[model samples]
Target: MSANLESVTDTADLAQSLREVFGRAQRALREQSGRFGLTPSQAEALGYVLRDGPLTITALAKRQSVRSQSMGATVGVLLEQELVTVTPDPSDGRQKVVTVTEKARALVAKGRNARTDWFAKQLDTLSPGELRTLAEAQKLLGRIFP
Candidate 1:
């Protein structure tokens, strides 16, 4: 094969591998959140609020690529669970902002700790050299992502 074609093929394989690994990791973390009785959409919306501060249902819907009504239903579940609070936007009374509640923070922290504990156990099985290589690979991944 030509060198250029070979490089493209290798990149495509690597992209697929990364996607599969990320998907599996997401599933594993999702399982941890499931313990809190949260659906994937609810958990994802909560995560976005936690990470990005308060946002409107429209904003969240745009971020998630879902419809406003769909996001409203997801936020409704979060509100019902007391995981989020909705208040009128100070600057725009016509729109409401969704904010994560303290209860949601606690749940997120617990879920994070659970996932970290599980990951740490898996890391314990790796040799020191393997760990170092993994760390370097993580840095490369960061460059690709960031």
Candidate 2:
């Protein structure tokens, strides 16, 4: 790329673009998640549990970037729904670890499958060159964040 082109790509510009794209993609995915009977927060919390396995309420709150009280409320709802369960934390007697139950796993899998199917359909509509461009963009996005 030319020096002029590089100069035009300021950090602010890149950050804004990343934020916009991420927001749009999340909104789209959340719509699909809703169809599977989950709110955005519920889906996000489930994903955190699925990816990180069992975690304490405080840890999950931190991972979700929300206050502990907020996370407690979310967890409470999840527990009431039987989507998650609390187990004794082996390392900390006072702390309980929250994990996805089989029901939550099934729900998450179904929701993820729905989102993937939607993306797959969209990808199918793209030309080979366009798909290649998206693949390259994915790499670029990873590099930008890293």
Candidate 3:
């Protein structure tokens, strides 16, 4: 609570720590999707498609901040793997809509379950005081993020 906010080193160290922890946590969760033979980009694209119902490659690319060609390649792999299907967009015949198949949904669900179970197991090991501290820290983070 007495930390110096004006110090450049303090800010840099805090930023580095946040990035390292977040990156590690994300990598661990992403590992759950590895068993399905999906690359990170493919997994991400499928997640967006699954969550948003259907989307065009341009939409996906824009959401992901990638070039359309890159998203198209990812979509191609998804189509070849039968994880997604593409059909003419009802609103725009010139555009194609990408949709997740049942297989992709099941895969995403299983991966999510795995990540949840893994994190829950980790959390279970925390002491009551530690858990409370983590909750307080999360609230502080929410203030910064939200």
Candidate 4:
């Protein structure tokens, strides 16, 4: 194989490794979110509402990358659980805007704190150099998506 071709292959392998690591991290977070009494989809929906405030059902569906019907089911469940509420949209009277409730916000905050605590404990076990490397990798990952 040519030297340049080998280098490209090596880079692809490294990117795959990074992708796997990210997937694992996401899985871990999802598992932890379940412990906080939320399904992965529900937690993700709450996260969007928290970040973006109230949104029409169609808008929330788009943000969650789910079909409107699927998002409607999720929103129904959240409403039943009292984690979210709907208000009539001012701009569009026919549409209802979904917003996270205070209870949902508290639940999300607790879940985040739990995940951060777990990550912090794990980071403490790593060597300082390892921690620094992780910090740099985080910055690199940000750039990769951005």
Candidate 5:
């Protein structure tokens, strides 16, 4: 409660800690996603679609920070796998929107469940204080992200 923001030193340690935590989370996701035979980017794109609903290729590209052409290719794979379908936009006939299919939803849900289960198992190893700290960290992360 007595902490001060002024006169702060270099934040290399804080930055490195964040990087390591993120790396571990990414690795965990990779293990779950690997079972589905998707590249990280593809998995990410599918998850994004799951969370955000249908989007056009250009919108997906912008969200994923990739080029439109690259996003188009990714969408092609999703389409070929029958994970998503492209339909004419009701408001704009010239544009097509990509939507997730039941199969894709199932895949995403399975990955999420697996990760949740794995993490839950790991959480059992932590003490009450550590669990409290982690709960606080989750809240802090939500604030930082949102």
Candidate 6:
């Protein structure tokens, strides 16, 4: 095979590997969140707001790569669920900020704990050699992503 062809093939293989790895992790988290009656997107949004509260819907839309209207709808669902609260911006009454409530905070914490425990159990099933390789790959991924 040509050198360029081989290089392209290697890159594609690596990309697919990364995609599968990330997708599996996401699915696990999504499954855990679903147990709490939250969709993956809703769980993700809750986690974000829990970590960075008092964010505007527009700001969240930018972060989540959705239109403001879409994010507003998402936030509205959280609002209805009593997971978040919207208050008028102190600086601009015309604008409002979304913040997580105590209940949602507990929910996020529980979800995180569940995910961590689940992954830990899964890792325990791996052989030591496999675990070492996984750890090394994670380090490499950190460098590549960071």
Cα lDDT tens digits, model 3, 53-93, are 89999899999999988999999999999999999988889
Between candidates 1 and 6, name the one with more favorable TM-score.
1
Residues 81-101 of candidate 1 have per-residue lDDT tens digits of: 999999999998988899999
On TM-score, who's better, 4 or 5? 4
Ranking by lDDT: 1, 3, 6, 4, 2, 5
- Cα lDDT of candidate 1 equals 0.90
Q: TM-scores of the models, in the given order?
A: 0.85, 0.74, 0.79, 0.83, 0.77, 0.79
Quick one: ranking by TM-score, best first? 1, 4, 3, 6, 5, 2
Which candidate, 2 or 3, has the higher lDDT? 3
User: Once superposed on the true structure, which residue ranges of model 2 sit more than 4 Å away at CA?
Assistant: 1-6, 9-15, 35-40, 65-70
Pitting candidate 2 against candidate 6, the one with the higher TM-score is: 6
Better of 2 and 5 by TM-score: 5
lDDT tens digits, residues 1-146, model 5?
Answer: 22444223235567678989999987886686464877767877887787899988778999999998898888888889999998888888876688999999898788779888888888999999999999999999899789
Task: Please report, in order, the local distance difference test score of every candidate based on alpha carbons.
Answer: 0.90, 0.83, 0.90, 0.84, 0.83, 0.85
Q: What is the lDDT of candidate 6?
A: 0.85
Predicted candidate 2 versus true structure: per-residue lDDT over 1-146, tens digit per residue = 77777767786698888899899998897677563455667667877888888889889889879988898888888888899998888998887789899998888788889899988897999999999999999899789788
Tens-digit per-residue lDDT, 40-129, candidate 4: 787678778889888888898898789988988988888999999988899989887999999888887888888888778878999989
| Displacement of the residue 27 alpha carbon in candidate 6, Å | 1.0
What TM-score would you give candidate 4 relative to the actual structure?
A: 0.83
Per-model RMSD to reference: 2.1, 3.4, 3.1, 2.3, 3.4, 2.7
lDDT for position 55 in model 1: 99
The alpha-carbon lDDT assigned to residue 51 of candidate 6 equals 85
| Count of residue pairs whose backbone atoms collide, per candidate | 0, 0, 0, 0, 0, 0
Q: Name the runs in model 1 displaced over 4 angstroms.
A: none
